[model samples]
Target: MRAIRSLSQGARTSLRQVLWGLVLVLALPTILVAAAGLYSGYRAEQQATDLRMQETARALSLLLDREIEKSVLALQVLAHSSSLARGDFEEFYDRAKTSGLEEPSWIALFEPSGRVIFNTRVPYGVKLPNSNRMDALQRVQETRKPYVSDLYVGSLTGQRLITIDAPVIIDERVAYILSLAITPDVFQGIIRDQRIADGWNAAVLDRSRRLVARSRSPERFVGQLASPNVQEALASAQEGLLQSVTLDGIPVRTYFSQSPTYGWSFVISIPETELAKSAQRSLFWLTVLGAVILGGILLAVLLSRAISKPVDQLVAAAQTLGRGGEVSDRASTRVLEFDTIKRALVEAAAGIRHHEREREEVLAHMAESEARLRLALNAGHLGSWEYTPATGALTTTPTCRAHFGRGADEPVTYADLIAQIHPDDRALQKESVALALAGRTDLQAEYRVIWPDGSEHWIRVSGRMRSGPDGHPSMVGVSQDITERRLAEDRQALLLHELNHRVKNTLATVQSIASLTRRSGDNTDPAAWNAFMDRLHGMAKTHDLLTATQWQGALLEDVLKNELEPYQDGIRQRIRLRGPRINLQPGAVLALGLAVHELATNAVKYGSLSAAEGKVHVMWAVTSGSGQPALLVEWVESGGPPVNKPERQGFGSKLIQRGLAQQLGGEIKLDFAPAGVRCVITFPISTMASDQSGAAETQQRYAS
Candidate 1:
């Protein structure tokens, strides 16, 4: 204690020393607070960057998994094709070629012995290269499930690619392995299309820790092993953030996400420099504040006695500002120097508040603009893009990323964007882009993009080119999904073709009915002519009913009602009809209509309808027979006269028993009851009963 006191006394308490002491006291806390604020802000920014990286990696992982699943699904669908099942290798090869032409994927069928049976890239019977990998095929055969292979050099194309294989099961055994081979170029395109900020990087690693693709410097690093630090970080967790160095030896803040489906990982790495920017800015401001405070303290020391009150007030105000608190307006001191200083403090506070409010307003406007952009993109199914030809940079909206089957935050290049387009459409798209860039024409193209999952979409793109201030060409455009419109067009064509087929069938039927009617009797016979006309009218009624139902089928009750319409009278209940409603195909409708007409004619001439007191009771029902649903119809007559069997089978009887049976794919039985005539028809309900339920259930349900 004596030594420290003696040293302090030797230093001497000069006026400048005292002022320096005061400045130290005032500046220490402010400096400490500023350092703390800087650190806190740095931490917040670092955390935000990590979170964003994690989210991007996770999203990219999910997209890759979905793409793998889609490829497997496509292979499965191809495996089940009838052509493949029939062992028509030539036909199947043609179909596979056409299907994969857009994707530029090679579709192949391989035997269990690892021999290629068919490949879309080569002629039939050509053998695949010996080095072609068959592990995925073997796995599919063993598991009888789809399997996606790891990245490898495809022996046929001598390119880095992956294969997705599905087993074709036949007679409870694996008959063949269907495979779809895709190149890494597609996945590279996916990585390149991510919308990452500048200086950030992303990569996709296969199960082997080999880089399958990278968003930056892909051509340089793809197929190489990932950095040891990244591999170590991933080994510990399926998803996490870490501080690491990239393959290029640059330090970065990295995040990784592993895919459960494909055993692959997506990684996002942001340069550490980006996180340091905010901290550096904070330090700059702190240094400037310290300098200003030191200058003020020196001035205060010189005029220490005269400016004591003002300096104290100024210090308080500075502390308030440093703490980000509002300053209240004060009355003028009336002295010029004091008032000037006070006014400056107030104006500084006002300026800070004004800037803060402006910053908030700007942030709000940016958020609103983003929201509106999202709404427009979603509502219109639109993907917007901006392309700079010189830089080859293709910036896209979130919807555009989705359209290209990329993660929302992925960056894209012009080459990567064009590569995602279907091979068949790439030439045209390239030409259109060239024309636009050359200022020869506005760009417009309708093309297809084959996604990594093997799903294809039609896209219509429209854009205009503009010259930048530096005279470089750029394009602004929107792409819309037009798959639905294309499908509707296809459906319309199919419907038109079906309409033509039905019209020809109808004409043939009319011609046959006319010939049959003419041959049954002489054309001169008026009764025969009348019978033909009546039959024609009955056929027309059936057709009308069928037309009303769009030719899907006609209700049995509707057909019966039309045939019995001529016999109905206001006062007489001569015909009684009872049945559960049944739907019949067009063929059943025609045969049944003629049979009912014949029966009615017979009843009018010789059965119950022959006398006023006579009555006809017609009933139909669905019943189970031979373990299949069957339709049963009964015709009974009463109160006319004693019924007798026909001497010889008439045309009506043969038509009802034979023609009706053949047309309906069912059976018929004619019964001659003692008191009246009865006919019972039984037919399989396969075609006639649209609903397979028993007639009793149907009737009960209808009643309810």
Candidate 2:
């Protein structure tokens, strides 16, 4: 202990000063050699710093991708749960609760429009509003692919988070979306695990160049945009190194790698001070060269020349490593220290290259994982069941019990399930199950179940038998609620019949128009033929709009917009249309489409649209303060040529007056004012859906 104290109290001495007193004349050559060595070492150290930074960037990038993959994998697993397809939210909620996921992570179910059905972040049955991730959900639905959303704020947690969404498709349509809300700490954990050194920086940025996780000042900078240098480096290359300043304005050399799977960039920055660390060995050799130079100038020159080549090689090797290129296995140098460094550099280059190869392989696998997530399988999720024939015991998922017409909490047994099946289909189901168990073939059966409420539903079951250790074959199978598909087939047949009846009615309407036009104008007139074709085209547009929605219905604004689209002026708003996107049923849509078509054509031919200064405003509103709300649409024209009432009503006038009443059970009023023509139509929403007018009324309305 006394010796250590005496050593600590000893004064420091300068080697150069002590040596200079003995060899003052040798100082010039020594300074020149030391300076040369110093410059070379500086360059080599800078290159090494860059290579290490680049390697750090790649390693962090791989880790970050793996972290994101975990969230996505969990989301996909939940998305495939059969309870979602069977409309069993309770089972889904329970499964999500026990998902075994870490904190700051939660699951959610969303409709295609972004309405949250349920969220595991909060208790079940909580009133969940629409999610703030509509754009991400919409993209997934459109592309039918898994997506990583940009940084967003969580609804329940109100913290900055990112979402990974996977679509649950049924009947080839995106029925629902499953998502995982991941806090930035999940990514920050990755950085924390790296244990990055002080004076160095690391960060993760989404595709928008916004910071997702930061190694420092995360609370203040987590969601902020990255520094300009980092952004440019990310944009410039898939992996690269560049000289820049940190977000804290510290000069640094930044290394970054862009993830091919998610398009995010991972960055690591090393300070400039680290690069300027002088090499101790090089300085020691320089002092030796100075002390020995006085013995022979030629020998000193020879030693200096000998060291220069290896220094260049080391620097060259580092540059090659930084560029991700192959390094040469050069022979050993004459200098022992240089030889050791050369070998080390060679090994490091190999190790880094090998790591890069592994990273590429991992990236490829992650891409495949993402691709598998997007495969659109046709089977709808419902429930799975396992049965032990020895004990006649049945274990079913919540969805499976629900398919048998039981509640989620209802206890079910094999006998109870068999009793629920229809009498006729029961035998067929038993035969299929028996055949599968005895012959070891796949079990396939379609049977009907009589619910306690007396509603009949179709269930499709498919499964296989597995041999147990006890020499008994256990039965496992999945069942689906195919009631919607079967009903769809029935609806298809009914629609075909309705289509035929509508075709005949459409012909009658066409005949009425031809007859009215023949009496009003000469049949051979080009104007009459043009008017007829135009009306046919208008009808075609309405059919196109309805077909796009599978004939379910369309918005009132869409029907009007389709009819008046030609007169729409983007800058002037000449044909002003103002209304909410009221969802009108098929009957209301068809009636409103034809009514608007007549009004628009008449105005373009003889009313306000005929004058240059003319304008038309078509507005609609749902009547309030009433028992059953009604729809009121008013078509008014102004700044027209004149207000001259037609002596005889043309087809346009009659169809608007009669078709609205026949097809929609509505009333229409057409009036001619000094400015132009005006028309008002009114109907009850309930009556519009019912279509009270029959085929006889339809033929009577067109009868002249």
Candidate 3:
């Protein structure tokens, strides 16, 4: 309102004067255009309605022809009856009667001249009526095919019927004519089933334009001729629509289709009342156009009043919103454009209010998230950056600039970031970024970055493509100095490879020793040599268990089970093992594995394991002895032959007694008492830290 009031009028004429003249000039063409629009719409609706009607007629025609074809097919099948050729009238009569012919229908045979041979409706050898359907038989004889007759009164039945005739050719000549006569009532259901709307009528008509079936008053119109308009249409075209009157005297627009097969027609008639709807719609448009032309006279006056109301409402709504208030009142307008503007203003104001609330909430969340992000980036030494392609601007934090070998005060560019990359990785980095852009995937590159001091460091740059505020492509990402982590990873890989080589060599030596022991053919005691081989296998199994943990440590129960599981064959409760979960350094895993193997071998040879019911219980747990934590594993045997202490300690006994206590700084007690052989191994529990390979080295060294 303020701006409009401030406008300077350079001329005397107001906009009303100019528009009043313009409306006078354009009113003639405007009327023409509106009339044309009305005509076009009515014509389009009529064309669509005509197409639908024509299709319905065509479909119904085909349906009626198909029904007649069914009768023709039945006649053809019955014509091949052997009874007809042999002149067995009684058998042929019975055959035709029981040939599944429809009720109120009959099959008959006639000579080519239409003399009746037999009729199924009468008894055998009875004098039957002469066949009066010679025209259909002549058609069959001439065409050498089946023929369908138009609606007619049958000479025998004395009722309106249609005939289907097939030629029973004998010796390449028309021998007999087989006929099936069905009443026109068979087609009444088909016409009625169309379910056309009220005031619309559908029908099936024979070739002579006589009604075979009618949807409206079938009893009155059936067998009667249609109006002349339909007859004239059939003469000119196979399918068409005509303005005519139905046989019942209803004025209608009729659509008709003639069947190519039976020369019959299907006609659908719509009352003129139904077709008047399109005309009514056209009249409605004409009235609206007339009102518009008259309304134009007041348009300039109304627009002048209408424009100011909406404009003033818009100003009022803006002021209310500017003052943090809501505008919800609405008023009617005479101009359509003003009404549209009012609706738009209402919806836009509501949206702006909703957006303002959402914007406040989002800004709060963003501030909190940004604080957490700053802490994480500083703690992890990550360098953040954002690039906008629209403005071609690269903005980075101080850390990102430092990552690219630039001072905090220096400006950075994409080219500078690329130039600082090591030459070997520069091309690869570019290729990765190109792929990221093309595939819409994240950009991740690990390459060497050369600092300004000429010292090389590995830097990993990661980013994701996003859309900027201007809807152009942009990137937001972080970079980090991963030089220390990369060095550690390299060192770890080397150490693992070396450890694997050493473990394989050690296991190979143990296998060689076991093989040599197996081949000790001259040994006096076979059990002794086999026992040594079994111990070697136990060590190899323990080695495998330790390797699964990267040679760091293993479970104590796992070590004992590996050595004893093989001896638990005969299932008379031969062995039982119980232990709490406890981890042992690799040295303890190896040493305890050997001690358990010797005890199990002895049990099988002469201890509890020798008896079918003999069993060994192996249990271990952590206990405090002498103010230090120690792992105590007890191996007890029962239900075996009596045992006694050996006067001279054998190799197994000496190794268990000496090697475990000396190398692992643990105590071992082997008691060869009378009841069973019992051994207890106690070792102080060691730390389960990652850097415990030295312990495994000692065990492998001792075995070698």
Highest-scoring model, TM-score: 1
Candidate 1 displacement at residue 497 in angstroms: 30
Q: For candidate 2, lDDT tens digit of each residue in 1-704?
A: 45645764694743333344435556675679677977687678767767877877887787777777877787777878888878899899999889987577888888998788888878888988787767888899999878988897766677898888898887579999988878888888888888988878888999899999988888988888988877876777899988898777789877899877788888887787765445655667677766666655555455555655676576567567667777777722334566688999999999999999999999999999866633422235658888889889799877889888798888899999999999999999999998988898899999999998799999999998987678777888888989999999999999999899668867876776677666656633457767777777887888899889877777787898899888877775688877554677776787788889888888888888888788998877656443655667888899888888878666677766677777777888888888788888888766554332221122221100
Clashes counted in candidate 2 amount to: 0
Instruction: Put down candidate 3 lDDT per residue, 1-704, tens digits, no spaces.
Output: 45544453335765566667777778878888888988888898889999999998999899887888877877877777787777677787888889886567887788898788777777767877676656677888999998777898866556899877889986578998888888877788777677877778988888899998887788888888888878899989999999998887889999999998889999999999888888898988898888888797787668866666666677667667667787655522334466688999999999999999999999999999999999999999999998775686899999989887788889878777778889999899989888887787898989998887799999998999998878889889999989999999998999999789767756654564465455553454567566666667677788888888887777766777787787776562567776556767666666677777777777887899888767787876566545665566788888788898888666566666654765467888888877787788777665322232333322221100
> Which regions of candidate 1 deviate over 4 angstroms?
1-26, 69-95, 98-104, 111-114, 123-135, 141-144, 154-159, 167-176, 195-201, 214-235, 243-253, 270-289, 296-665, 668-704
Q: Local error of candidate 3 at 694, Å?
A: 99
Clashing pairs for model 3 are none
Better of 2 and 3 by lDDT: 2
Candidate 1 weakest lDDT stretch, 10 residues:
695-704
- What are the Cα lDDT values of the candidates? 0.78, 0.78, 0.78
> In candidate 2, how many Å is residue 157 off?
16
Quote the positional error of residue 68 for candidate 3 in Å: 1.8
Model 2, residue 449: what's the lDDT?
94
Q: Please, what is the TM-score per model?
A: 0.44, 0.39, 0.40
